[model samples]
Target: MTGEPGGAATDAMQFWDERYVSRRTEHGRIWSGDVNSTVEQQLKGLPPGSALELGSGEGADALWLAAQGWNVTALDISSVALAVGAAEATKEGLSDRIEWVQTDLATWRPSAQYDLVMSAFLHSPVEFPREAVLRRAVSAVAPGGSLLIVGHGGFPPMSEHAHGTDFPSFPSPDDVLASLHLPSGWAVETNALIERTAKWRDEQDVVLVDTVLRVRRDE
Candidate 1:
C-alpha cells in the first residue's frame, strides 16, 4: 500500500474504512455477499466448531459458518465494513452466532484458540507482515483443527479489474507451506490451485485461480 501521512495502522484503518464507505455508497457493497467458492468447498462435511476468520470482509464466510452451527469470530480492520456484516447477521437472525471484531491483524494477537483458524485473501497493498501474521495464527488452532489459507494466484489475463497486484509476487501453495515451518505432528492436507467462478463487474463470470493450503495438527 502507498504510504500515507499517518502510520501503517492508522493508514490501513483510514484507507479501508473510507474505501468501504465509498464502495457502499456507489455499489452497495465492495464484495459479492456469497461465500468464496473455495471456502464453501473446503469446509463442507467438516463438523461445525469454533472458527476464526482473519480479514472477514463483509462477513459472507462468517455468516455462512454461523448458519452451519459454528460460532465464529470475524475480524477486520475497517469498522465501516464490519458494520455492514453485523447488520446483515442481525437481519438474518444470526447475530448471536458471530462476533465482529475491528482490529488490525498486523498488530493484533489472539488470546484464545479456535477449532478452525482460516484466512482468505489476507493480503494488503500497504505494508504489513503477511507471512509473519499467518504464522502467528498457527498458534491459535486447536488440536486436530485446521489452518486454511486461501490467496489469489493471479488475475485473469489482460483484465484491468485485477486485485492485489501490488505484491512483488504471488506465492505458490508450496511456498506458503514452507513459510509456515510446520512441525512433524502436523499434516499438510490441501496444497494446490483451485479454480472457481468469479464475477467481473457483476456482468460476466470469470475463472479465478486460488492458492489454497490446509494443514491439521495431530489430535
Candidate 2:
C-alpha cells in the first residue's frame, strides 16, 4: 500500500494521505508551473488518447492534459489532494475526461496499455526498484506511443541542503533511467536537464533542477 512517491514499504499511500490532510488544497514545491513547462514541452504534439498520470497532485497537469483531449487517468494516494483535484476538474468541466484513482504506486499493477504514461515529480524517499517500475510502466505503453518521466534533478541549489529536516532528497534522471534499464528497441527522443529558479517573497532565489526524458516504444 505504498504511495505515489515511493518511499518505504509501510503504506506509501498513507504517507501522502497524511501530508495532504494537513495542507488541503495547497500545491507543494513539486507543483510549480516552471517545472511543469519542461513536462509540457515533452508532451507537445501528442494526439488525444489514453494516458496514465502517476502521482497526480491537485490535478494541475492532468486537467491540462484532459483539456488537450487526452483521456487521462490520474492516480494518487492522497484522498484530500485528489478531492481538491476532482473539484478542480469539475470546475473546469473536465470531470468526464478524467478517472480519478486512489492507489499506491508501489503496489499498482497495470491492467492495460496506454498511449502515454506520465510520472511527474515522483520523488521516492528511499531506494526503490525504479528500473523494474519504469520497465513495467514502459511495458504498459502501447507500441508507437511514449513514456515521459520528469522529476526534480539531484543537483541544484539547496538540493543537498535538505528540506525542513525530514524531506527526502530528490532523484536524478540518470538514476531513474538506470533503474528502468530500457530495452534496445525503445529510443530516447528527448533528454535534457532543466534548471529553474523561483523568486520567493523574501527576494531569495529558490533553485529547482528537473530532468526530462522521453522514450518512444518501437512500433
The lDDT leader among the candidates is 1
Candidate 2 residues 36-153, lDDT tens each?
A: 6767778868888999988787678898899899999988767666877788789789999998887766667888889999888776554455556666787788888889998877
Q: Write the per-residue lDDT of candidate 1 for residues 163-199, one digit (tens) a residue.
A: 5554476799999999998877899899999998777
Specify the highest-TM-score model's number. Answer: 1
Error of 2 at 19 (Å): 0.7
Q: What are the Cα lDDT values of the candidates?
A: 0.87, 0.74
**How large is the C-alpha RMSD of every model relative to the true structure?**
3.7, 4.2
Query: Which residue runs of candidate 2 sit more than 4 Å off their true CA positions?
Result: 1-10, 24-35, 126-129, 155-171, 199-205
